[model samples]
Target: MVEFTDWDIFRNLALAARWTVLLSIIAFIGGGVVAGILLLLRMTKNVLLVGLVRVYTEVFQGTPLLMQLFLAFFGLSLLGIDIGAWTAASLAMTLFTSAYLCEIWRGCIDSLPKGQWEASRTLGLNYFQTMRYVIVPQSVRVATAPTMGFSVQVVKNTALASIIGFVELTKAGTMLNNATFEPFKVFSLVALFYFAICYPLTRYSKYLERKLNVAG
Candidate 1:
């Protein structure tokens, strides 16, 4: 049996954590782009576009992320498109993050006063123009804190990507544990690493929430 030292485990876990961070950033940014488009659709009065966006949000948000990953990884394989774990993980996380972000931004848009929309229209602004210039600018204050908070979720959720053989932090920890037969120490350290990464963002989100309230 091989005995893994703390340094060895830490080294491997830290290495894999970079991929975790990378994937989270990819997912968050990609999701933000998609969510922004969806937000626009929801704000518009087009019934067909609105219904399609609503269904997209519901389908992504309604399902378990694990199932999404599995379907992306395995289901695609059945269709003769040999997908890698990285692509599947990114695709699933992007979709998952997009749904929640759309909802978050939608809430922010809805929280805007009715008079703002009327006032924008009175100034000869169409829906897109109003959103671009008036509504979104004001809603930034409401959206910032929640968006930051959701980023913490994005980081944590990257762990699920490990299930599909992506060699991220959690997957690295499992491999190290398998070699050392030390699940408790390995997982505890893994948890601590996640905490170290996520705690500051969580705290900053809270701080922004308080600051936004004071500013308002």
Candidate 2:
């Protein structure tokens, strides 16, 4: 067993945490792009497009993220597509994040009064123009808090990527625990690291919610 000092473990875990942050950012941004596309498609109110988006959302939302990671890593290999852990993890996380975000944003948009849509039409605004000028502006205020809250989930979910050998904070903790044989110390530090990353977002989310409620 390689003896790891307390400082050595802290430094290594801190280094690995960077990958966790990077992966979460990639997943959140990629997912946001995809969800934006889906939201637009659903807004079109085309039966076929709506159905397709609904199915896509249901499939990803209903399934476990761990299973999605496994499929992304292993299923593609079975199809003779060579994909690295990073690519597979990114792909799976993006899809999973997109599904949930789509639903969250859709709910926000739907919460608007039908009169708003009618008023937009009254002003001779087309669907896209109305959405761009009116609906989206209002929905953004409603969506901001939940979006930040969801981001915390995204950060924590990066830990799941470690299952597929992504060498993130959780994986580093596991590796260090093996070397140091100190589960209590190693995992406690791991939990602390996650808390440090997530707590601010959580608190900020609550603050936003309260502020928005008061504003509303």
Give me the candidate number with maximum TM-score: 2
Q: Pull out the clashing pairs in model 1.
A: none
Q: lDDT by residue for model 2 over 1-216, one digit each (tens)?
A: 567899999999999988999999999999999999999998786999999999999999999999999999999999999999999999999999999999999999998889999999999999889988999999999999999999999999999998999999999999999889999999999999999999999999999999888256
* lDDT of residue 111 for candidate 1: 84
Query: All candidates' lDDT scores?
Result: 0.93, 0.95
Question: Tens-digit lDDT track for model 1 on 1-216?
Answer: 767789989988899989989999999999999999898888778999999999999999899999999999999999999999999999999999999999998888788889998999899998779878998888888999999999999999999999999999999998988899889999999998899889999999999999898246
TM-score of 2: 0.97
Model 1 residue 171 distance off true place after TM-score fit, in angstroms = 1.0
Give stretches of model 2 more than 4 Å off.
none
Regions of model 1 farther than 4 Å from truth: none
